[model samples]
Target: MDVSDILASQISKHKSILVEKDVPLDTDVGFLTVTDPSVVDKESYDHDREAYLQSTARDGIQHLLAALFSLPTLPSPEGPLAQLPPPTTQLPRAKPLPKPKPPTKWQRFARAKGISSQRRDKKIWDDERQAWVPRWGWRGKNRDEETQWLHEVPANADADHDPSKEARVARKERTAKNERQRLQNVARAQQGRTTATATGTQVDRKRDINRTLATTRMSTASMGKFDRVLDGEKKLRGVKRKFDPIEKSVDAEKSANLALIKQIGNGAPGGSSLKKVKRDGLDSESGGNGGAGGVVNVRKAVRFASGGQGAAALARKSVVGSGSDGRQKRRGKR
Candidate 1:
């Protein structure tokens, strides 16, 4: 008889397998593809494959039975059929492992939000090395840079008051005016102290007049030619000169149009003014204008191509080149 006829006849003698009939005949035996040798060790599988049929132990016979059950037909007549014993071994029923519990609400929320659990629990930034470093919310060193709005807030005033919002805005405007007065007062106080330190009390009255005259002269020099300076351009003007709106408005409009960005609140975004302040070619390095002493030490570079010997001397001596050597010397001493 042919091998196909012999196999068909033998398979018909046994009961059908436990799986559903609608499952493809090929699919029933396909689970052998997922058998990883690493699970039961390669050596053990190889040993069972090569061992003598008579010497086959309990586990080896069990594996052989499993192979038989998974196959389509009983072993062939000449394929160890006569030597094999009747199938009596059964695999132990495995208890299903318990399912893991779902994560807590906070954990689920953090995962959904795409933030760390620890960060969600804590405030935005943590200070390190004398710098206010932000941990979340924004990526930049200056939080204001990331902000969309720049509300003119009153210095030292509460930002979140509803009833006092108009008053707060007015307060900020008043403060700006007050700053000019405060600057004048400070200049007068400094000049008086300088005179007192260098000369006798007899010249104190005379020194006051001289100081006022000097401040008036400085104020005239500081005022810019502009009628209105843009916020961006205004910030760029430090102690060197007040901003000139006439010179800066065109530049500010150009910057705003470069990027079509939306503001966050009522205020405008991007503080392009702050960015311009950084780019105005001022000496940004340490001790450029203002240092730890809260004093701006301005040193105009003397180009050797020009008649710079006099300028160089003035820099070295810390003297104002206005013929009053005694006052210059006193200013240097302070």
Candidate 2:
């Protein structure tokens, strides 16, 4: 008993009302039809019939009326439409116009022969004459008064013209140029050969000098002088100087060792165990392993030397002999 119940009750009542109202048999024909059949007068009926005819006539002939009243309507043609004539209007024909007058005898001669003068055209305003005077010449304004330089064709010499003179001149110039170039090329080639032979001789001389230098041995006379100095130093009374080679070498070794120890100590903070092993390998190579390790060590030493002064200490201390103690440690003893 809520909104649905109310809606159902209203729909049921409206359905019955619609059923009764919609029955064809229950419809009132009397109310729909005119009550008096004679109520329409003859005038009214005729007027209504006339009005209907007028409305249909207006609706049906509206287009025809428009056509009849239209201005400038076109007429339809049969078969092919006649071709329209082309427009007569066209651009004006250009006139020959007036020709200008000549300036000098030479210019007139060149212009009459249809040759252009090297002189440029110049226009100047003449105050007295009230006209422009040109520097170079031109044809006159009046055709009849124009300078008559035109000539009639010669009867005898009109048949032949030859270009062999110009052709011969061009060929001569070309031949001269080619001959000059050929001479230059031959001179250049001769000079090049002489220079090459000179260079070869110089190179051969240098090679000979180097070979002689390499094969020649030092003289014992130089060593004999050094031995004399040593003997004199020993015999000198109370002038004993400690200039022993063995002592100098030992001192140098000790100094180098000290420098190496100093360098190792300075780099110890940043040094890795791997670097120590690499240094050991380098030592083995410098001692004359001469393998890949030797090459690597060479590169490393060069790089370290380039890096800073620390490499100087290491280089000074490093022994440059075969391995550490002059032994090829890996090979079996021979």
Candidate 3:
């Protein structure tokens, strides 16, 4: 037969063998057909035919051996392999790691032996009772209004009145008194007067003046000599220039005395003329010319007796009546 006829017959035989072995023949398994003579080369066709025959023979032998020995079938890629269990020899079981234990109280104490422990209790030292006291529990700091030591009674203690009770009663009385005083102050304020308690008595006034003088003396004593002199001069100036309504009455009294002195110096009756001058001055406020003239004469006489200068020197010195340089120097020496 020719090459084509021989190849076709061989292909038909292989097809029948595959069918008996239950191997499905698709495109990969070459089958010679009459209409396609150039499908595969001679060398390639021979190699493919050999491989197909070998694979089919191997599969048939394996199946026959399995059936004869009654052995389990080898796993296939799609079926047996997927349902197979994983190899135990490849992956051994792993035991869980052990847990670490916590530190004990003794270990903690050793770690913090040198450091101070944090306090949770509210106990404080009581100086009066000489003991430690809890602030807010039973027998706490606020159990009694008085201190614990103060509340303690002796074995021989008599049934005397309680000092704490007495203090409370006194405090209440003082509060009532203060309330009454406040009402009195309000009433006094409505009447346009200061509170009675605020008003100083004559004795208090005298005491205050004495205190002021004592303080003044003390302050002056503490000053330097030059400062003391300046302070004294300032005080003298203030006294000389200070004017008051009281001073006017004092001046009137002094003038009356001066008039009496003048009358006595002139050998005239003092009381009668003085009375007459005052009566006339009172009767006509604008007609005090006689009394004025008499005062001038008395002033001149007194100035002359004191070795004072004349009207010309008086005018030069102005109202202060400072004398000549010689007298001023003499007074300075004194």
Please provide, for model 1 over 91-172, each residue's C-alpha lDDT reduced to its tens digit, 9 standing for 90 to 100. 4659876755445444567799997754333333435435555543345333432242445555776756443456456655
lDDT for each residue of candidate 2 in 1-334, tens digit (9 for 90 to 100): 3699888888887633111112122211222211122233457558798875564444334433333344243456653332333333344659865654324444556778999756444765545457776532352222212233443444564355323434446656766887786676666555555796778887999989865643332234553334334333432133368853655677788997898898887655457889878777676666654455565544354445435444344344344433353322222121
Query: Using alpha carbons, what is the TM-score of model 2?
Result: 0.12
* lDDT, candidates in the order shown: 0.48, 0.49, 0.52
- The count of backbone overlaps in candidate 2 is 4
> Which should have the higher TM-score, number 2 or number 3?
3
Which run of 10 residues does model 1 get worst, by summed lDDT? 27-36
* Candidate 2 segments whose C-alpha is farther than 4 A from its true place: 1-162, 196-334
Ranking by lDDT: 3, 2, 1
* Worst window of 10 by summed lDDT in candidate 3: 28-37
Q: Give every collision pair in model 3.
A: none
Model 1 steric clash pairs: 232-273
Give per-model TM-scores.
Answer: 0.14, 0.12, 0.16
Scored against the true structure, residue 41 in model 2 reaches a CA lDDT of 43
- Residue 167, model 2, lDDT: 42
